[model samples]
Target: MEFCDECGSMMKAGEGEDHWVCDSCGYEKGRDPEAEEAMETTQGQEVSEIIDTSDVEDKGLPTTTVHCPECGNDRAYWYMQQIRSADESETRFFVCTECEHKWREDDH
Candidate 1:
């Protein structure tokens, strides 16, 4: 792509189409009747920005005095989950160690 006024580097096309070679100082030069067009890249524009926070700080998950049909609270914060069948039995789930209130006990 033409650029080697005796070693400024970057030419390369010679073997006589009228000469050009200069891959760093083999300096030939003389082939430019227009022919240099290859450099293209395009793809930029994406932004989704989303933020939601309920701020939880519970870090304690195994307690159980159970009984908090919504704030009746007598301790609670358990877990069991297998959600049915593996020969059924494991779905206890609760959570109210003072009203963080969440429940789930069904197996009938």
Candidate 2:
């Protein structure tokens, strides 16, 4: 991506053009988007140990409908945790009823 040197704003290319024009300061620069194409990168990531409770026979936890990423179960058990700052909302936890796959989502 090209940026303006005068105003430090992002620069854009015009139709049938070979230069980048600054939207803020009108500064122009040469651009070759094909040579600057982004390449995807991947690396081996370690899986951390997680506590799963799908096999435990407990009926006290609240149950909800959620698609399980592991076993494709539509029903799951849920809980909430305040795993953030005091001002932030709680994180909702879910465990698949069939496969016990655990996941969480933060309250917006």
Where is the poorest 10-residue window by lDDT in model 1? 45-54
Model 2 stretches astray by more than 4 angstroms: 1-56, 106-108
Candidate 1 per-residue C-alpha lDDT over 17-52 given as tens digits, one digit per residue, 9 for 90 to 100: 688787776877566565433444444321222111
Model 2 clash pairs are none
TM-score of each: 0.21, 0.46
lDDT, residue 51, model 2: 40
- Cα lDDT computed for each candidate against the true fold: 0.63, 0.72
| CA RMSD (A), model 1 | 20.0
Task: Write model 2 residue lDDT over 1-108, tens digit each, in one string.
Answer: 667888988888865678888878778878776777664444432123234464544657888887887788899888876666779897788877787777885321
Model number with the top lDDT: 2
